[model samples]
Target: RGSLDLNLETLSGNLIAQNHSFHVLEKISFELPRVELCPEVLKRAKSFVLADPIFGKPGPIDVLIGNSLFPQLLTNERHSLGANMPSALGTIFGYVIAGTAPCLSTAPRASNLAISLLSTTDTDLHSSLQRFWVQEELPVYDKKSEGELACDKLFETSHTRDSQGRYVVRLPFVDNLAYAKLGTSRPIAAHRFESVERRIHARNSSPLKALYIDFMDEYEALGHMKKPPHLNLSAPHYFLPHHGVVKEHSSTTKLRVVFDASSKTSSGLSLNDVLLTGPKLQNNICDILLHFRLKNLVFSCDIRQMYRQIKIHPDDQRFQLILWRGQPSLPLSTYQLTTVTYGMNCSPYLAIKTLQQLAQDEGSNFPQAAHILKHHSYVDDLIAGASTEAEALELQQQLIELLRLGGFELRKWVSNCPKLLQQLPASHQEPPVFLQPSSDPMFSILGIHWSPVTDCFKYNLNFTSDAPTKRKVLSLIARIYDPCGFLS
Candidate 1:
């Protein structure tokens, strides 16, 4: 109704008339009083035709047929119902009642129906251009929420370095509300552990069960988790339910244990529910990729067990307990996670903040490495490069030394330059399968496939033969994974 470019449907069929033009109204506003008619009047008519099936019911009008199009729709025939009732006019489209019908109710009625219309084209070109630019402009990052601000302040004031040089941070809880409201989680944890145990013991799952045991054994051997000294069943503690996630393609670790911190307790509150997710600290992924592409020589690596490398404060370790047993014949033992866990709500923030803090503290000695850490790194992955071979080697050395100061080991090192790969220890370098000459080996750089030999990003898209629906097309598009706009 606001613009002349319109398509409409009616009770009979689609209104297909076209090419007719009329003067556009700058503005129009009106009010229509409610009308009621006796049902008997239509019943007594010789012939009946309804333009709208439920015209008697009060409802909002979708469109108004103005005088400009009324003539085209007329058939020049009419039928009279009665003296008080409206006459039915025949049109090529359908029959429409033209005159008003007498109100059946004797009581007075007031009209609240109002309609307003303004031409969209009335706006000047300058105003329209301004609106277009406003929409096209990049969105400004929103101000941090109160909880985020509090988390930042807490980390800054409380985070400290441990004897092993690893950074230790307290959990960012939403005040003390989470601790006060926490209920017994042992029963839930026990139930979940039993379920996982049953799955591992299922027929033909011997390999999976052994892998799970080895993962948990390595977890304890590395001191990421430890048995509590004293038993306190009544204490406010959480038991994280954990499960194994197997990635057959992984080079170093095939199976990894993922803890579930979001499991609800008896009070219906989970550890994640009470935790505050701190503000994002990582550089924009697009910016990182652009910086990565600028240099001729590029290399990528990730921190080994990045989250587990950072210790959680002793006071907050109680909230990260878990139930584990090597065999189904043994009873479940409670173990506390001493490090920042993978599934915690604030783990990402704590890990990134710790990295930033390391750079800030030691950047004076390693300026180039510090800059790469701040600007070129995304989460735990470092995708950075240099213009020359000498500069690339220097950067690699400095990054390794700087990260070592914080007890963070960078592994899975891959680069386009074979000389650079030779410099890294065999254990630290990525598997030789990625560097094999016979095959076009591909490496995953933050979910995007990258070919080191050609120094080009590659996509592995698998499309289904399903019908091309809106959802299916979007799903296919999402699989492209071209965050750097290489296709654009």
Candidate 2:
């Protein structure tokens, strides 16, 4: 139906309904064979069923049809719904999806109605809303500007060194902040950190230790982390009211490092509770993919350590502190992360803001590559295509160089174009079949396991030692993150 909501309540997961209208959600339509009801049957159905309100009298109704009854109205004779609906509605039917008259918004309690003729034959419906909002503009509505006058992200920075001679960034408190009270003093989650730290040390699993080592290596290399003195620091250096947790990852045996920004500091508030989850800055994943497929020659690459590449204000480093120890015998040492760390509330905003800033600043020099950077990238991942192999190769080089201009590294280049792949280092190419995860070639494209070689998606199912349960089955199914609904 035209008004089916994704969250509509149903006894079976598979939904089948004649009519549903949810004002809280939205609607779409698809094409279908046009069918019409006889006057007598249509009048009876309308008098009995279609007379009810749609989501509580959503203004005057233009058209009404009880889908369940409409199916029974069709006869041997077939009627086609073609491009002549405009003329038919004007001369024959009473109400239409459009109006030749001006917008009703000029009068109080006045609103416009939009309707779509849907096909009952196809369940997988996709539609375009571009032509639906073409009614005359009666008045202007004010909207917010792109560049906010006073943004939460705006900050002042200061650089200082801890006793170990390691630099610590300090973001001074905002003067006019009232909505979210981020205490000047960060509350330490001492017990939580100690408990987790003790578990990691006591369990002493090889994978856990290895993950930590890898974390430290990258932490040090990026200069995001620094070792503080064994003793406590003086006033003004905030510990950032945060902690760490190791999360389960399916791909590799080793877990991933995650900082718990919600950890209560010495103050009652956690960083996440106070920080703003900035505007969604990147394009939709579907839009990005659609843009990539526009050209014949296609290739994709990702920025290495996407968040780590963007440096935060030096003054803000003190808020991202964590405790660490190289050896079991050694005491837990204090360390401050200087750059954008994973699991922070504003990490996505900072990362995306940086990427957009780079594109906006250097876009003129590399127009094509810059356009892709501005429109196609989802966070750090880049997907772009060109009509010709030579154009594709040029885009790749220009993309890498343009990103490099801002000290960003682009690696793991894969291409449908053989010429472009040849230009990249062998290390950047796809792994051999034998080394792949399975016999099926399911390489990750924007987090979905897709076959670039075969131009389709790849799925893997495996056995588990865990006992069968409803929750477990649901969890496994939920892990199947196919946002585009390609499986359908």
Candidate 3:
């Protein structure tokens, strides 16, 4: 029928009528399958007529209702069909059996199914707001696990300062016997080194190869990596496989050699597997950003090679060995990483713990800087400020001096006040162009972009013209990166 008013009766003897006239399909050419209801379900739903009049026998479809009429047909009441069986739903037209049922005959038959769509914008918005609140809120203190407590105990008991003022710490092993489980790793390390060399040589230009060599050479020159005096292949040692990573956007080193401590030894155990990953010691990013916004003269700086600043104990250096050769013609040599390597599980904890220890030891000389280091730093990046320009300058000086006491150098300094930055050495500050007011310089604070000239945050949204699917929509939403909820 083109348009009609329909009335339906329920098993409860309630009469329901359509709110308004609605159009319906007059004839459906296809045959609908017969749905056999369970005898027990029918007994429980006594005197209730099936939603479909000819539910138990195959028949040609007479009328079809669209999704717009679902609200009038459906109800919240439901009757379960028991385990592993379809359930019957309470609708205005009586009880409707839903879900899969066995086929009555060997021949295939079509089944009658209704699909309904509802708008979920309100539900999605509510969920999004909840996630935003949880992420932007301050982090709560969590109790340390047994492994973390053990790591802390090891650091407190064995850490010491060298003549150069660098903090030397031992690796936090699971137990005293953890190192004994390690097997020979030199063969695997050699294979991985060959693979890396082949990849670099296959590049179109030789610059990549040269860059890789230069990076390893610098690592050696800085005293971070050294050739072991004695070769003891029988000793319990772990060798890390290394590869090069290129970042063209970086202003300093373009190629960085990354050591893979997760590489397993012959005994099927990795260095990371035996070491205890210490508890997270850095302040949360939300807290750091909140304090950054509280001051009039804000600035940002980060430790240069932060992990390499802390020295590892000599006894643990054998576990951080690597294979390197400047060229294919040169003989391969074994080198031990003396500093806290980045790929190890305990590196972050050791570096951060060292910083806190330094602050506690010398905080009395520079209280403001000490507080900032302890509370305003997120990992290696420092985001702090003061109420005035003079206060900011003094804080900056104190921070530089205090960090120097532990042999930690800060670089990439940027600020809203030009005069404060002017006091810093040209080599120590970020590019001079970032301070020019005519050219608004935007740098990343964590992942969000901020413009020093305008003193405001910026967002670059790159949306695609592709059709909006569930996955694509979610991906686009994730790229927003507004941790501070500035858009809200």
Candidate 4:
């Protein structure tokens, strides 16, 4: 008999041993042709098996609503309450009393007659009523009438049940719901526009991939969240150190990209083999320092969703974890990210690494050009900087390609420059067109506008410039200040 005819499940132990003794394991290894698996095909296969009508159509939700393992068919379709009583009212009473479900303030107001009926069954009903009902001027319930007012009172309070019967409290459902819908609608519509814009501006956002290796303890220690709630809500609080170990150091013309390790979490990198390798450190420093030089230019652009353009290696995805609808979804590494969400430790390094790689390819084609690209993550802000119009353009081109490589698509990037040049007198010498961006809020760099109303830039300025010399001096300023009266 062929070995294939043997039923392993039904085979006796002696028969199995005899077969194993006679059988020789075939020393065979076949290579699978490396074919790219299409996601759509796999999806179709899984869906066909899982959702096939041959497996039987999905029954009504109520069919399996409350089935338990031991008493699987415990169906109590008919209620013990009188059939004349409304089913909804009978259910409400049964749930509140027998199931120990709490009653809402609306419960009492709606079932005034029911409560009185319950009082006859249980002598301590008055005490239960007093405990749940506060001594307020509540609207009277008429046993004879069922009006809109009665229905309104019934649903007025959001209620819950505890061991002690039920409790009811006024909820902020109206405001919360309105805000939720607004938030949901706005993002959906904006994202639709963004999708279209991203396709149009795909070239600008491509060649970047980022990783966020958040030194969590350090950021917390630095008090990135130290500010009071009021200030935190108004604006993001940077995890920058100011006092003690983190005092601002002297400025470097070459662009100092220092990872302040003097702080407590300074040694945190050692935990995850995230050593600042010589080349990686050098690249990081280069990205940071060059950003300073780029800050002085009038027409500066930001690569939209730059970090998300970087992909994290699939093998390294175990670290990235975030909750979604009570389930873990987002990974800690930018490598697997599909959206540009904030807060990741490795995002900066990953993004900069991707950009550096892109720059290498772009720069290889233009060896003699002076181009610089800088990236940094003060938490989630992936700042980029480049010198010269050509360099900036190159950087933008490389970024677009890099982002596409990393699997993210982006839209048009708007550069912010002062619009004052448009109003300049014909005789007034206009500065080179390359050095200007619009001053209007709609035209500022990094997708932020200058808030003329607030006399400040809409987003936090990571770098600034001021010069004592007659010529335009280019350097990062000591601290970001109010943009109002900037010339003075």
TM-score of each: 0.69, 0.58, 0.70, 0.25
Candidate lDDT values, in order: 0.79, 0.54, 0.79, 0.28
Model 2, 1-488: lDDT tens digits are 23343332121122333345432214332111112222332232232222121111122232344564344333233222223221112111121222122222333433444555535532222221111122111234345343321232352123333443222322323333521354444223444455445556665566666676677767777686887443344533444423334655333324546777765433345566555555566677766766665667777788877776656555456566776665657786678776777887667866776677667668899888888888889887898888888888889888987888776778777667788988878766655232255555445667666555665556665647989887556445555555555554
Q: Show the lowest summed lDDT stretch of 10 residues, model 4.
A: 55-64
- Alpha-carbon shift of residue 15 in model 2 (angstroms): 45
Pick out the ten consecutive residues of candidate 2 with the lowest summed lDDT: 86-95
For 196-262, candidate 4 gives per-residue lDDT tens digits of: 3333234553321000112223333433212132222122111211111121321111111122211
Residues 1-488, candidate 3: write the lDDT tens digits. Answer: 23456754443435554454444443555455544444454454454556653354445565556566678788777766667656678777767777655444554555566644333434444455556567667677989999999999999999999998989999999999998988678877988898778768775748889999899989999999999988576788899999988988665679888898887776657899899999999787867887788888899988898899999999899999999998788898889999999778888899999999999989999999999889889888889998998999999999999999999999888889988888878777765334346657777787677888777877777778888888666655644678767776
- Give model 2's TM-score versus the native structure: 0.58
lDDT of 4 at 127: 36
Q: Local error of candidate 1 at 481, Å?
A: 0.9
TM-score of 3: 0.70
Query: Sorted on TM-score, highest at the top, how do the candidates line up?
Result: 3, 1, 2, 4
Highest TM-score among the candidates is held by which one? 3
